[model samples]
Target: MDLELRHLKIIRAIAEAGSLTKAASVLGLAQPALSAQLKRVERMLGGRLFERGRHGVRPTPLGELVLHRTRVVLPAVTELQEEAVRFAHAFAGAPRFRLGGTHGPLLGGLVDRLATAHPGVPVTTYTSWSEREVAQGVGEGRLDFALIGTCGESPPPATDRLTWREVGTDPVFVMLAHDHPLAARRQISLADLAHASWTDVPGDGCFADCFAAACARAGFTPASVYETDTASCVHLVQVGRAVGLCRATFPPTPGLVTRPLAGAPLSWRHLIGWHPGAPSAGLATTVLGHAREAHAEAVARNTDYAAWLVGHPGFGPAHPAAV
Candidate 1:
């Protein structure tokens, strides 16, 4: 007595094919069976649905109207089913968390710590080259959290939707090849190397801004700089052509040593952020705590390196900690 999807489908096919026999064939049914189904639908709707001719068939005014309505209704019903399926599948699958960051050194050991602390919670990591992307990713649900450098103003994840905690702060140190003359000095200043050739990473990147800011603070603008985004900037320095600054969180390759500036206060602050809507699972909390500890450890180690530079045989004196 009630209309159903199969009845609506039959009507639509008949309207398109223009013949009962052809419409039945399209529906994978015999002509008689489809005709009976259509008649039942028409009776339920209180109207005749089609007109038969010697040659074929055509829809009546009532049939055309019903078919038009069904065309819109059926696809919406299908979409609802698919959307329900997508929800069930995504939520019912295994738990997965994604985190992104712009700082490589700070992220270096996090995976191991997370795996050890939350062995069951799968954490995926993504690297973003800029703070804008990191913040956007968290706000848009693409990432569960992000770690990045912050200057005077807070970095992106908008404060209304996201919150952050400072992990650690450390001075950005100029890394030079061991054989470079400044590399042998106890402490180097921006003035000491202002006129020297330098290797700079792309300015659009967060590190580049931090580096440029440090140079400006050091009373000089970086000039005659070779721009590179790869870690090879350190190797370029090793070859004795140019010097570059690397944060403590970056990998410590064989050929480079990081030294404090003679009397400069330039530092990069590391922060971790998460969305307000994101779940605070126990594992996430634990992983965040580990990241904070790891950051502190890196800062402490770099401080010891600075202390050694101050008293070392070749370098004359150590400068105050770059705050």
Candidate 2:
């Protein structure tokens, strides 16, 4: 019989199991049948693939060569099947929009716009503190799109076989208690806050290091920095225990205020990503448009950020977009 994918699987199973009996058990075939099948494969290939040995079966030189090829072929075929499934889902009546995001306001805004634009399509979101995780979800077909950010011209997460687009950009802002002394200032100087402790949402990025470098440039080592969840970061800032680092579009909190840092010492760039081969890729442009619109709405609603943007020419999407 010609060596087909099934034949390759059988060879791999036997090699992995180390014996015909174990291989049969794993492959759900009777031992005798498996042995017979193996004989045919060996006969077709013109050599003994496995040698009968005291301990178990070992691959012959021929077996080793075939096994090497099997390893390469199996994964490629598996990937082909998986990509086909993703394509099918995209073309099927309606594929749910599976969005992966690092915690932020842009994700919610995009979801809202997508739901309104594609009325009947179901929408869901997966949140992670790591941009890599969000990007990975898209690359792995678990998510249709990824919403993530990079710090001030830093590259986006490293994910293979995916396209990343800049949704927008904003200067990172500082969050402080409403009554904090710096809260009254329109913009705070990084050097001036040398004595203050800080808090920020935890993430897998170089932002923490970048913040440190920014502080170093400002001529003082920063005080204690607490990495925590968003809620904890807010509470820390609320109680005046620490100041929080936030995106420019961070919504107003009753007891907290967000202000930009002078010189735009730290900044963030919003990014949207997706696997180009995914079935859902067809909607990427549309979704990107919505993301841009969401970002614009965010820009409009945050009056302080809007005023800040007026003077900071380079901190927004690379191009104009509307939805």
Candidate 3:
């Protein structure tokens, strides 16, 4: 009758799904079996964890407490599993160096630099939709290093096992059609776009949230008409349907024009993270130095951002030091 990892998992599943049937489906268990397990778990804990309702189930106060603890425990377990795999690979005499991040021009630049610096060290790369995922990969040891974006916020909870170095800051820009009236302006403000439709990636994370908050500060809620990737967003803009957010590091897309936001209402920090035990401090330093260089090149190529950087001296390194 003692609790185990499986019990914790079941608790988390039920709390997340908010219904026994849905939780059973997610866990690949029959409804009856899952219900029986839940009953056993409740008995062991000496309390009811959920209250069944017409809509679904709601966690009781005790259930919330258990779920909170399980959230912490589960990620630690995953990190341990990843570390075991890494150790096994090391013992097998062919340890792999892996890196992960969201897809961007800087990623290609960083990869090329790593290749030239390490010469023969084979590297594995993974891409995710969000910086959070890449940071998690580094923290869990699945990746030896990761480059991720943050809205000047603190790192996530799982990052306790990782060390981070800021690579650069990218000022956010608004991307519009070449002929759009706003495109004629050298710089635009969020308030000017209050009536414009926006196309953004579908996510409740920092990327979307930061833009939304900026819009709120500009005295209007954004009218998001489409949720899609950057290329699709550009297409939407090309058709005169919506405006999209862009980073200074983004390459120019055909039929699109980018302008820096006046006062830089939205910007994010680029960071490189790795486990404390990862390779060598020198390697991490080299990666960060290359990243800064890549960022400088990106800014130089972006005319609007380059102009903005001239007036804003402390945003990023004026001249990135040689790696």
CA-lDDT, candidates in order: 0.68, 0.88, 0.77
Q: Candidate 3, residues 163-224: lDDT per residue as tens digits?
A: 88777877778889999988999899999999989986553246677777888888999876
Supply the TM-score for candidate 1.
0.61
Cα lDDT of model 3 overall?
0.77
lDDT of 1 by residue, 12-80 (tens): 888889899898888899988887888778889999888999978887898889988999998888656
List where candidate 2 sits over 4 angstroms from the true fold. 1-85, 91-93, 321-323
Give the C-alpha lDDT of model 1.
0.68
Cα miss at 51, model 3 (Å)? 9.3
Model 2 scores a TM of 0.75
In model 3, the Cα lDDT at residue 144 comes to 74
Top candidate, metric lDDT: 2
Model 3 Cα displacement at 256 (Å)?
1.4
Ranking by lDDT: 2, 3, 1
Write the residue-wise lDDT of candidate 2 on 4-26 in tens digits.
Answer: 89999999999999988899999
On lDDT, the stronger of 1 and 2 is: 2
